[model samples]
Target: MHTSDEIYHRVLWDPRFDPERFVMGIAERGAPPKRVALEDFVPGGEIPWHRVVFFEADGHVVWDRASGVDRVGEVVDGLVGPEPGDVLAVPAGHRTAVAWLPPDPLWAPIQHIRRAHDRQIRRWPPHVNVLFGFVPEGEFPRALPLVSAALAETPPFTARLAGVHWFAHREGTTVWLDPAAAGLEPWARLRESLELRFPLCGGRSHGFTPHLSLGRSPDPHPLVREAEALLAPMTARVTELVLLARRGDEPMRVRHRVHLGTGDVHHAAEPPPPGNPGPPPAV
Candidate 1:
């Protein structure tokens, strides 16, 4: 996710411009992915067209847009999203844009996001997504056992999931729900347990903001208001925890799924088993 500082280099929500239009700015001369320079760009009326690309630590994986597109990457079929610090091709146009979009609900997006989450639930194994901070590949083992123990010690509970809403972030507007409102106690329990065990996962300066992300909205202001009106809060029962491995060429694989209430646990997939040249596996 682009922080406010970084996103400001691209788009903005201005009252002076038309709500339907996103204001795209000119990137510095000769930036990779081409700097956008939309003609007749208006503050709120019509902004520049923009698209973005995400980069993994090692090299380019999949463009957040799609595959049928070239220059961004192999023209794949589906569209993914950009992670923190990933490059973006900030552009928008009058054409029927089909890729890298927001929740396209005409009314309530809460239902849309909930449906998406439910679809994901049905496909991948269910997991209690507790915050452990992000451990680099090198520190995976150092965090695995601690996180595992924390999961073992924790019990299952229901988390309230309000309908999806927009967050006016520096990185455009992100659509997320506040699960902590209902899952606060359990969340704290897990955080404290994990923190006491490891250095914890977050930076020292920033606290934690546990959220279930739906997606980032290109245009946030109207959607935020519409979401506030149409989105309905719901609940998700916390029972199991799963470690998901994302691959560029395949469906996200489930490394493991552990039932929270029961002591029973099983490893669905083995590590880079024998000859893997990497740190220990982790969620």
Candidate 2:
């Protein structure tokens, strides 16, 4: 966890709970604890949760462990969720986005570089963002049908991650990998459609660059060169667009998956594990 100025900075881990499972960012000194959903922190895996052993010193082991839950639910029930009538601060990560999450093998190399250079490494997994901060989570129910209609005629296509590039900003230089711009016309058309539906969320901060972000640094040329050697051209089949949401600065988690062509919506009960590495393996 990043350093906090707050008086109480806590992380929770449990050796007995999924062995590799832990949860953090759940508590702050003065605020109501955020809702703790098993699907948010853990990735989907084979292990069943037998019990929860909570430790105070620290803190992802599965997504959708909901069905296999036993004593674990009992522990989470007491620890999770906001207290009644408590006011909570709106998190910067509150906004939502639509993106393509490439398979782990494809993005793992870029992620390896990001682990050292990217501050958002823990906040989000690797993805090629389509539309970001487009609407609020509450607006998704409405947004879903709009997205479905916009993409109804569009079919899934394959995207290639081909090269390294950068976006200059006053804060730093953001290095990214190109998702082959020539093939992104369909993505552009979909954006135009959604913009018609949600005008306020239409402006592109980086102006329509279809690249998967690596990370940012004040002087990034050296790291950019390093990434160039480690990175290889990769292709990912784009079958679905993932709708991601977060609660009050918590890490973003999958909310829904909108399939291409058919526009069939799937409520994500257990999102697949993120490409980002989790806790160190048990010794």
Candidate 3:
């Protein structure tokens, strides 16, 4: 499946398909498409984990599930999906998409528990973004203004969120369904038009993996595993976007929120530091 033009994705199910087989061209300014073929030192069981880590590819439209992933827990936490992934190809685009507010039943507990697990979770930040494309570096500071204009000019789009599932990744890195797959398309189309002008301007490139993120590795596995049944399906019209600022492993600081259809920017009462402090060291 192609998430965007020039970007391709394939789910590698065959155990024997070594990553070293194909040559790919990556995205680089004025650089010729490098004839790069890679090798894999992975076994099938670890592919789920490996797929989210050990790869550092970008600028190429080839969405190799077997391509560029880095092994750091924080990087992998953001890169991997909520579900255990057999998927490859980190998405290349902007994360400036719409937002979904899950029902209280699902949202409340996840936030509480994930907060307690804050010191341990690598990338479950309780937030999601509909990335459009990677933007040129110099143009990023205008993110808020651009989003504001689009929201005011564009009408609110429809989207649905209706599933709850538990997926385990790596050493107990578990996540629940924010199910961006269920709701992002309509918003994705909307974000696409503006994205042509702006790519990953809002945040890091997380590929196509989209989920609300319940918690992470050091969380209680059996508890999270069983609580899967407690979740109920939810669908709501996404009407806004929450701009976030984080400080390592402390907590997510809400910077601003932009209402859809109005493009109104709701700045935080106390804004966070200018930028994120990034992921903390693994405990």
Candidate number with the higher lDDT (1 or 2): 2
Q: Rank the candidates by TM-score, best first.
A: 2, 3, 1
Expressed as tens digits, the lDDT of each residue in 1-283 for candidate 2 is 1111110111112112332233423443477444343324442233222222222211221111223312222335234311121111112233678777887667568778888887787677787777776678876776787677656767888787787889889888999988764486877766655544443453544567677888888888987898889987777777888888866766667898888888898876445465446322122
Residue-wise C-alpha lDDT for candidate 1, range 42-74, written one tens digit per residue: 333433324333322123332223332122122
Candidate 1 at 249: error in angstroms? 5.1
Best by TM-score: 2
Scored against the true structure, residue 52 in model 1 reaches a CA lDDT of 32
- How many clashing pairs per prediction, in order? 19, 8, 27
Q: Write the residue-wise lDDT of candidate 3 on 21-49 in tens digits.
A: 32343333476433433433232332232
lDDT of each: 0.41, 0.58, 0.43
Q: Which stretches of candidate 2 lie over 4 Å from their true place?
A: 1-94, 204-206, 272-283
Model 2 TM? 0.62
